[model samples]
Target: MSSAVLHRDTRFVPKKAIGGQGCYINLEDGTKFLDSTGGAAVSCLGHGNEKVNRMIKDQLDQLAYCHSAFFGTQVSEDLASFLTESTGGKLSKLFVVSSGSEAIEAALKLARQYFLELPTPQDQRTRFIARLPSYHGTTLGALGAGGHVLRRQPFEPLLAKNTSHVSPCYAYRGKKDRESDADYVARLATELDAEFQRVGPESVCAFIAEPVVGAALGCVPAVPGYFPAMKAVCERYGALFILDEIMSGMGRCGTLHAWEQEGVVPDIQTIGKGLGGGYAPVSGILINDSIVQAMDKGSGVFRHGQTYQGHPISCAAALAVQKTIKEDSLLENVRTMGAYLESQLRQTFENHPYVGDIRGKGLFWGVRITWAVWAETFTDLYMQLEFVKDRTTKEPFDPQDRLSFLIQEKGLQPEFAVSLYGSPGTVDGIRGDHVVLAPPYIVSKEEIDTIVNVMTRVLAEVFAELGV
Candidate 1:
């Protein structure tokens, strides 16, 4: 059969998914694959959750759509209130949007408008600073703010020039040998400060970063004190602090908000993926009181609107998802299950030759693959040289090999029957490969064991086929 739909990769049409239940996805061919990565970490509640389904159905019966400029829906307002209250008023307002990218676009625009509405109107603040090797979103404004090299490459000329990059707080690669966590954090803070100065501190709008980097860096969590230091730098420059939690927040990291563990609250936060538990396309931005107050006093308007900004069905789905998490105590399960998953991963692959680093928080984990073994004694420059030499050193696989994608393909086979989230460009923006595991929060110990077991066989098979 010829398909008219344009798929992500035009070269190959993907297998059709017929249904999903809990942690497994059923294909049209009758194969059931374990969904260990939650479909890009979006299906936090897994699939076919009855409560969320019922909520959406109910909302459909009531009101399905409402244009933000003309009318307001109770579901939208309720969802916003739930989110802001979940933050304990630290983030005082919410702006509903349809996807993570749209959430980021809203954040960027709001940040710019926030400054414009200030008493003195710092309109000169047009620049945004984000970390390298981070994924924000695909929209033009969001892409410009993100630092993922490959994603931004083709659109480089079209992207806004207002955004600049800085080195991420990647302990595995960025930290020098024998550097204490404090010194490492200080170095990053100094670098951020320098970037602000270089870009004219007074002209910068915000310094945006993901609390736990996803996709581009492969689930890298910053070392302790990292965010606090970075936030301090932003505060020093009077620039807003924006945290992109599209992949790592909404209880994905064993907390309602990933920043809760970092000891810093962002002035503006973008959330998505798990927000609606895959039942609906939904995402939003959490704005702090100061920014909300500024707009309230100045323009009393956000200066932005989308036809589906507060779509009723999407809000209902998200509201139900959040309520389920709280009532069912899924976060407790996440913490317990996350610990078990971490231990299992370490026990299985801590010494595996192809595996270089294991990193993550909660159920969000990444197994970084490398051809070379890493040692604590190696200097930063020495490591770089080793990577250049490829095999027999702690270097990333060649980009052409597509090791991560191959592993993912293998996981879907009947022999493996697991859906692993494999990604490339983990080292720089195009060199390294890694597989992320973000099973549903409702996942069980038995399911975790199955995921690890399948991954073990899948990796060995792929590497052996490559003769590595």
Candidate 2:
């Protein structure tokens, strides 16, 4: 072994990625694995897509990069047009950036700028209210906007001030047993209203959230009427409503925008992940007509700008990704296969002692495990047979339990499925984990069946070893 310059984050060894294509990865050590989580849900079309690669090659042939301060490229403009066109006329403007975090930073800043169009000066704006356990981004500005306590703890002192947090519409955890959906929605709305009052509604520029709670909450959609209620409250205070669709948009959730599923729409939206399909790094903000009109009449130039705001190559790749989705009619596969996947998972894990929750929409799904849920017990099969048990099966903590580590040690590539979307809850960021499963949009129904079969067997095998 040779010494290399060391970086931080002890999560993984500094290994080289040898090759990857179509939901699989090859390590330099000759290990192969399925990328089910899609590289933190970024690779919607999978890796090494030929069309996307070809488009990048074509863009490089024309021009690779252009500083946004000087010229506006055609590729970027067309990509923006595609984004707005997909939104069905309401979202009319797009601003591109190189990453999701940048997109979020722009969204927050743009909301405040939109309010500046009012006679009130910028100094009058000082507050941002976001949902708890939601992750917006890593930059200080975006971090300040986010409410994931674990991610923000280290930089708490350095984060910008005047940011407040409110409850997320995570009905799975937040809703009381006796509470009806209507009552739950009303309660959350009241909480939001109370938060605005405390923060002084006029001082609040925006209320931000993920349409589908991504990493922090494990692919949870809000209860019915949640978004509409939230939107109504934001309108009452003249504050912008921002939806972070970075993890749930661009057909990953079987919709162009997850907000489309809700009765109401957001004033501004942040999208990435599925945008470039991992062919190129790109993210952006979609501003609604009202916000754009405000800026058009007030100060025209948005206060925020990035050096690589509209990278030609990234835009070209994203354009190809969008085109492939349209031509392939992949959203049909996503919806049909999503239902099939849900059925398959429910069947495989329904009687299992450890599976607490199997919930999500479209291709985005998660398997939540509680401390009381142990897979090995195989106890009371009849008791576990109910479709929606809503029972707690506390997971076993043997202190020696490390199932993923065992899988890695085995070096057996998953043929039926990519890697599991794994996480621990109630134990901070690292513990109390569960696995996530998000396959490619082009995934066949047979592929969905296979993923469930593999996970069923894998977990069973792991638990057998643990003697649960």
Candidate 3:
């Protein structure tokens, strides 16, 4: 058989997903796989949700699409109101887009436009500061503002030159032993301040970061007081503080917003994935009242436009998704199940020889694989186990092994039948491997048990096959 569609990996064809229901997906060959990662943590509400389906159908009957330039749809307006109100009026405006990448593009443009719309028009502000090993999106603007190493490598020349990178607040491999969290935070803050000073603080436009880093760092959250301190540094330079919650927000981290747990509000926040629970292609940016006021008082319009910016069907679906989350009180379940999942993971793998770190919040979790061994010299044992030769050093596996991808492939076998989001380059941008598990909010205890059990077997098999 042949395929016409150009897949992400041109060399291989993927299995056909014929249908999805609840927490599982059915392939054309009759194999059912547990969708533990929810297709990159997008399907928060699970699949085959009748309530959301009905809403989309109803919206199609009423209206499907509308250009934002001429008229606005009620569904779009309602979705915006729902989002803004959810923030308790902290973010007074919303700019709808079709994907996380689009949302990031919009946020970047809005932040730049905001400075231009200010009373004095700080046109000198041009640069953006973002953390390394971060994933924002694939678009050039978003890629420029992000620090994902491999993603930016091919298109380095095309990316915007106004952005710079800084070290992430990664406590696992970053925080020194015996270093207090406060001291680590202070050091990060100092580093940020130095970057600003080096880049000329007056020329900086914003400092963008993920509330909880997504694929690049594999669900790494900043230590307590990290966000506040970083935000304070941004304030010192009068630059906007932008949070990319594309993978960690919208109840994915046990709260409606990941920042709710961090005790800081970003000047601009981009959200996606779970925003519409994968029912529709939708993402958006929430803007602070100050930025909205500046734009409203000046240009009176954002200098950006997309043909499908506020598609009615997308908004209707998103509205239903948000309504269901609130009406069903699913956030409570997220907290409960998240805790259960955490306990289960720790109990199962806390002492595993190959598992290096297990970190996450809410439903999003990452298990990093590192084979640490105490040996006098490199020998057969070292050749057999490739991951971090020494755990104390927190070293990473060779990128050539593709260990995470191997685990992902093993998990998809009928014997395992589980889908885990596996990624590499966790340590720097090209040297580590980890697998993320983000089941739908509707996942039950039994389902979680199955996920863990399957992962346990899959990992054991992988290690045994490697003769580690």
Candidate 4:
């Protein structure tokens, strides 16, 4: 038999997900898997949401697609309005797109365009400064703006040199034991300032950062005062502060906009995943009033656009998702449930010998596993599993060991039947390993407990089996 699809790992064929409801996904072969991370934190409302599905169907029945350049749809306009208003009009204009990558692509272009639209056009401002352990997207432009080392390595030659990176605000590994939170923030701020100076501040367009570090670094939130410090540097350099809330925004971090908690407003922002709640492929860029006015007074046009830029059905679905979140007062639930999750995690993993750090906000949490410690703490388990070589000095197992991948896979076994989102290279973009969990905003306390219990069991079994 021949297959038309090209899988991520050709050797490992994945089971089909036939259906999903709430937090569980049913596989083709009848296995029910509780999704703890919502497939990279995309499914905020969880699978099979009736309201979202109905909205999609209603929109489809009315109208679906049209060229945005020639037509404006009510659903698209409403979603754009809702999103801009959600930011208290700080982000004055919205450009809807199909995915997070495209939203970021729009942001990159708009940043350059914003500079160009200035009274004294900053035509030389072409570069972007992002942070390491960052993942903006996979498209060439977005890829260049990201600093996920391993992902960028193979594509280095193909990627543009328009973006540079600084250290991410990862307190677990980046902060020193003797350093205070303020001092750590100051140090990271200094690093950003120096990078801007090194890159020639005058020529830079923006400093792009995830409000909360997402996949590349697990779910690391910046230390207090970090964003304000970073924003100060960008402002001093006349650079726009671009916050990538693609994974951590839209109530994922207990707030609609992650920056709200940081007490900073970005000049530009990109959001996805939770926006459409995995009901539709929708993402968008929200431009500040200043930038929008500059463009309005100047060329009155953004040079870039997509054919499916605000597809009617996509916007309708997203609008419904947002409405449901608001009407149900789910952000309150995120706060309530998020606190519960944090407590549960601390209770479960705080003293686990191999669990080095547990950090995050709201529902977005990361568990940093010290694999070397894993071999030491569970000598018998290590002997039975026997994947890594060294058990001391914090040395990671060989890349071939694929510890993170193995744990992700192992979480789905029959005994546990739970799912987790795992990523490697948390330490430097190639060595450290961590697991991220972003349960649905609607997750119940009972469900949260179940997720924790299932995850704990899965971890134990993975250590014993080296596979999920």
Candidate 5:
């Protein structure tokens, strides 16, 4: 009856996801799964959005495909204007791309170009600094900037060597127990300063990060004063600040933009996932006036683009999605529902011995399983880390040893999926294992409760089986 290629654990065929509505994905087999992660936090407006679909249809009716160079479309500019307006108009330019990875690649290259835009001989700087356990994207350039050891393994040689990482603002595992948030933040900032010094500050072009550590740390929001400290350090080194909001922005968090909560703005910001609300594949980078002015003064051309750059229909869909969010005030909904989700998860999993942590902002949240469960399942992950020595040379069954894979499989069950929003958990600071949750902007209290209930059951089931 069906002959189409499929992926991801062929042992269990996923029911064909033919459609979606609000927080639920509909299958051709008449099954529905709650979209807790909003398809990797992309579907902010949820699915089957009549307004976005209408806009796409309207744009397609007028023009389907137009090369973005010679002819700039009204829809793209309008979408850009909306984004700039939403972001407080600090950003002057928006370069639309097709996906988050491409957006990140563009942002990285843009930072390099911006430095070259400097007229002085100091413009040759091409170095970038990021944090460990932070993921930028999947493409070579983005992955190069990303510090995830597991994702960077096979192509490690191909990645740009100019990019290096400092310690993430992660406090749970890395922060000393005795350290206050302020002191811990200062320590991280000091490390960053040292890195800048090590790299010879002038040679570094940008300091990049996911405002909230996503995917790599189970939605680990930085400790207090972290962003402000990092921002100050970046400015001290005269490096551009590039914040990746692809996963945490677009109202996945309670704030319309996660950076709004972070209390610092970036010279360049990349966003996706929620922008088009899964109605279309669209992601873009927002440029502050400084970067734009630098380009104007120097290399006037970004020299980077895609065939689908600022696709008219994609822009139209995103614009409509944005409009709907604004008109309906979905971000307010996110804040309200996010609080409810947090309370539900905390109530359900906080005391559970196996569920180690529950942390996030807005609707984007995560649950981490204890390291005790790691040794039993997903043990192969240990060998994947390049830095770790297989001390089968008399290694103990350390909980840390089993943490990564244990956290991953712990979330998967017959009912729901977490970490679908757009985060991976951290293990020994590298391998992915934590589960993230990113429900839609339109999620209800009932739906949030259901998600928590299902998640609790999954954690219980996994832990009980492990005898934890």
Candidate 6:
């Protein structure tokens, strides 16, 4: 039947998820599937978490909506304080928004405004340098700031021209065979410096990047010293360092913030997904004290405003999520379970011909599929299937195959009954496929075993179906 709501895929109607508990979701037909990806790693504590639900309800009962421009609510105030305190006062100001994309928009504007608010207004500093294959958000400003080729394709004509892209510090693809980690980082730093020089360093406002790349490039983390090197480049050019930790922060990377593990602090940080843990649509920007002081000394106000900037209910939900993470000691579980998950994945796919690389941090892992050459030339059924290879190298598969979709489809079958996050265009904007797995922090050893076992079956079935 025709529906009123427009779905992601208009051709197919999805099954209704009527119930969920812990790490499992039950459909209307009573089929339960393990939520291995936590709905794109948003449900950190998992579904039907009583603590978060209770807080949301309580906030609704007490005070649901209050425009930030008019009045301040305790819920929003407390949430902001909690977040700032969590950062040890490094990030002293919080700008609450409803989604990750909005947070990014705020960060971009704030960074630019910060320059303007300086004692000597840097009105010319209007550019941002982000890395390629990164996913920041889909909104116009955020999209302009992002470097995802496919995402930026149709909107190329309209996206802001001030933003340019540099190579991401992806070791798997960027590092040379003989290059040491330090040398690779140095090389990447040099490239970034060159980009700044080409774009005119004095005209740049910030260098935005994800601590651990999410959907756009799968869950790829930078090699050691990568962040410091990049940060050094930004500092050298007097540009703010903006970290898009929307997917990697909020304890998803075994720490409250993914940057903590890298020993670099971003001047402006955006966090979402697990911040509210699927309890509410909430995201925020954390601003450094220095930026805030600059603005305070100047116009004494940020030049941006949103009607629902500090939605009380969203803040309450996120507060509860953070409190739970702290009280239950979930980050410990994230580390323990993250190690177990990585080990299990390595053991299962280490010898699998189709599996090329498995890399991630904490609970977020990405399994990159083998390139087209391996799949077509080495696999048994190369001639039977319609293979689409990269025109230049004939290596990676063409994006037209929808390989990631097939893996996700097979994983959701009744036999496997699992949910895995699938992302494509891993090699440039039109090639490569990878599946990302981000289980909830509360996942158990047995649950990890189930996820890996089912994924193994899913991969085998998908490959067989594809005649590979």
**lDDT by residue for model 6 (1-468), tens:** 677778998987788899999999998878898998989889899999998899999999999898888899998889999999999989998899999999999999999999999888999999999988788999989999888888889998998898999989876567787999899999989999999999999999999999888888777788889999999999998999999999989998888988998999999999999999988899999999999999999999888889888899899999999999999999999888888887777777655666666778888887777642221111000001112233223255557668888988888778888987887878786677888888899999999899988887887777777776
Candidate scoring better on lDDT of 3 and 6: 3
Q: Itemize residue pairs with steric clashes in candidate 3.
A: none
lDDT of 1: 0.86
TM-scores for candidates 1 onward, in order: 0.96, 0.89, 0.96, 0.94, 0.89, 0.95
Higher-ranked by TM-score: 1 or 6: 1
Across residues 198-299, which tens digit of lDDT does each residue of candidate 1 receive?
989999999999987888877788888999999999999899999999999999998999999899999999999989988999999999999999999999
By lDDT: ranked, best first: 1, 3, 6, 4, 2, 5
| Global lDDT scores for all candidate models | 0.86, 0.74, 0.85, 0.82, 0.73, 0.84
In lDDT terms, how accurate is model 6?
0.84
lDDT of 2 by residue, 255-338 (tens): 767888887778889999888888889999898999888788887888888778889998998899999999988887778777
Query: What is the Cα-based lDDT of residue 404 in candidate 4?
Result: 72
lDDT at position 229, candidate 3: 98
TM-score of candidate 3 versus the correct structure, residues matched by position: 0.96
Q: Write the per-residue lDDT of candidate 3 for residues 139-189, one digit (tens) a residue.
A: 998888888888999999998899998899988778887999999999999
Stretches > 4 Å off in candidate 5: 1-6, 9-13, 371-425, 429-432
**CA displacement after TM-score superposition, residue 66 of candidate 2 (Å):** 1.1
Over 4 Å off, model 3:
372-389
- Model 1 bad stretches (over 4 Å): 372-392
Number of the candidate with higher lDDT, 5 or 6? 6
> Per-residue alpha-carbon lDDT of model 4 for 1-468, expressed as tens digits?
345678897766788899999988999889988887878788889999898899999999999889999999999888988988998878888899999999999999999999899999989999999998799999989999999998899999999998988998876567786899899999889999999899899999999999778878877777779999999999999999999999999988888888998999999999999999889899998889999899999999999989999999889989999999999998888888887887777678766655666777778887777743321110000001111222344454456567778778888776677777778887778887778888888788888789778878767876666442
Which parts of model 2 are misplaced by more than 4 Å?
A: 2-15, 120-122, 371-390, 393-417, 426-431, 461-467
Residue 281 displacement (Å), model 1: 0.2
